[model samples]
Target: MASPACAATVSGAPFAAMDFPLQPRRPTPGQRALAEALARGEAMMGEGIEQLPAATYTDPDRFAAEMRLFRTLPQLVAPSALLPEAVSAVAHDGYGSPLLLTRGADGRAHVLANACRHRGTRLVDGDEVVGAKRIVCPYHAWAYKPDGELSGMPRAECFPGFDRSANGLRAYPSAEIGGLLFYAEDEQADFSDLRALEPDFDAFGMAGLHLYERRVHDVAANWKLIVDAFLESYHVQRLHAQTIAHFFADGITVADRVGPHQRAAVGRAALLERADLDDMASLRRAVTFTYALFPASIVVVSPDYINLLVCMPQSVGRTLVEDYMLIPEPPQTNEAAAHWQKSWALLDGGAFGTEDFGAAARCYRGLASGTIETVTLGTLENGIADFHRRIDAALAR
Candidate 1:
């Protein structure tokens, strides 16, 4: 039998029964004190903000502050460029969120919340062929049109005064830029427009790309920690010595903060080099640019593909990282798919899921130990400092 429709209206409160990973564990007095101290310490680039002391990493209080920052800030989800046709929409539940991407009959993309407006059941399951037309919920037979309006219900007359016009799938705000889609929970966010970063996207050549393969991982670390790993290449030599070290500069990295909203850092060489494809007609010419759309999303551009990282905080210490690899649209072939899969596995296995996270995991353990007093920010990694400051300021509001 189909599950019953939920009672809450989409706009008023689909979140009534939703259990988001928003709450942090209770903190002790010492932890609270330490968090306050760290927040109060001014984080200027060349001043006392040199390196986070070992004590900061080990303190329970500092961890609390990190959680506070994540919960308060408005996170960046997608770029405006990717929304030309909304392909799919993702939703947040108590555990993790769901993403729904679709290509409509009109050859347009539309993304909407993955949760059914009724009873909160997931509307779309897996990556199956949804095709064109309305989305029918497998649970209670409720259906919604592509534009997120109510279409049908199993038994319309069972309940009197049923008003389909008053209820539709709740949609979070979405935008795109540089061929990337962006979603945000805050409807009032002004930074949703990517035209502000036109020069950056043009320089990266992200306009002509096509969405290809995407990989999602439930990473066991704070979202900020995952983000910090990508802002600088300082540890590339030490941590990723064998896997990705050959393609990156171990010591020299450039970090720049454009404003409160974005930070970017470039390595000497692109990580995913495909020099053998000189004759291949569709190869994107640029490689090796790493940029972060402050608060969450990170993008890596290579000659063959562009890797976009979208992260969401799952708990005080856990995060979900979505890694998307976009390549030039090519005929669907087994060999091409296999090659792309191998490329994605290689990057996720070595750079992020392993070495990068290995370092951050240690940092987490140290933070809980109360041994590290504060985190030190490198001058070259000024972006890191700016990120910390922005978090502090946003949470303060």
Candidate 2:
């Protein structure tokens, strides 16, 4: 489908375009829960304090369970905008397996195993492959079509009874929605958890947005800890006081869950003075919407751009984070470029890297000390509790 058109502003200049309309003013059921929970001064608590045991972060068995949850369940792999054209492909290594995402000749995206079926050789080595008609295995010179079909073999006549069709690359079960690509190792894995966020996904124009920049961080903490840090605003005043503390209201947040995914918005200090709380779109302008897609993806929507943080677990105490900054469009002029550059410097460089992840590293040291039996989540930190509950549920199943 064609993208939505950009409207004109009062001065006749083109307004920044978005694929979907602004979110409605009426509160969704989840939003209402958030409002009520805030009024009660209670954060959404999980089953019990035992839900977050220290071993959940440091134990090998728990880490293995978490890894199984990641591989067997549907997880966000890449944004649709990353493969905008035919013959485009990107390699990902976050899901405990090497994955190759390719846009085929028909312009449909596909997720395939990166290993060649011929001799189990890696077809593409780097993070992305663009404008390639076929994936050629470096070891055997076997080539496969972008859709994972076996196309050519080096010595076909050597094996008279060889069946090329049976040697095609293995493909993972994948789905594209709201401009994002999700895949799971288990072909029968259910994706209703992700599909339930269609309304919020569309409202944010996730699919139509362009990826502006990306940064990778190797954090010294469990993946869950990093997820917890982003979903709450309780630490903003103390941790980010020098950077973004003044911009946001302290200790005030609203959160609601859409199936396995959860979203939380912390009020901006500038808008706290306004009496009206009914206009959702206006409120969105004043707050940052943090959507934690179960398993490990967190998409943070600010007024100007979107930040996609993928927490990829590497070991019990190490996680690789890929942070992507997506904008409505590429900057056309020097002024626009400078503005986006400054935005990246503040959000990704200053606030996230320096403050958030830095704190996570220190927190990991304490958790690994073996003194604390369990960590606690406050009422305002309900998102963290909800996340742990989802993890336990997924592992149980």
What CA root-mean-square deviation does each model show from the true structure?
Answer: 15.1, 6.5
Question: Which ranges in model 2 have alpha carbons more than 4 Å from their true place?
Answer: 1-51, 268-283
lDDT at position 102, candidate 1: 49
**Residues 168-269 of candidate 1: C-alpha lDDT, one tens digit per residue:** 877655554555555455566554334465555644446555566555677666667777777655566567666666553333433334455453322222
* CA lDDT scores, all candidates in order: 0.52, 0.71
Number of the predicted model whose lDDT against the real structure is largest:
2
Worst 10 residues of 1 by lDDT: 1-10
Note the residue pairs that clash in candidate 2. Answer: 43-379, 179-207
lDDT of 2 at 383: 60
Q: Considering summed lDDT, which 10 consecutive residues are worst modelled in model 2?
A: 1-10
Output the TM-score of candidate 1: 0.70
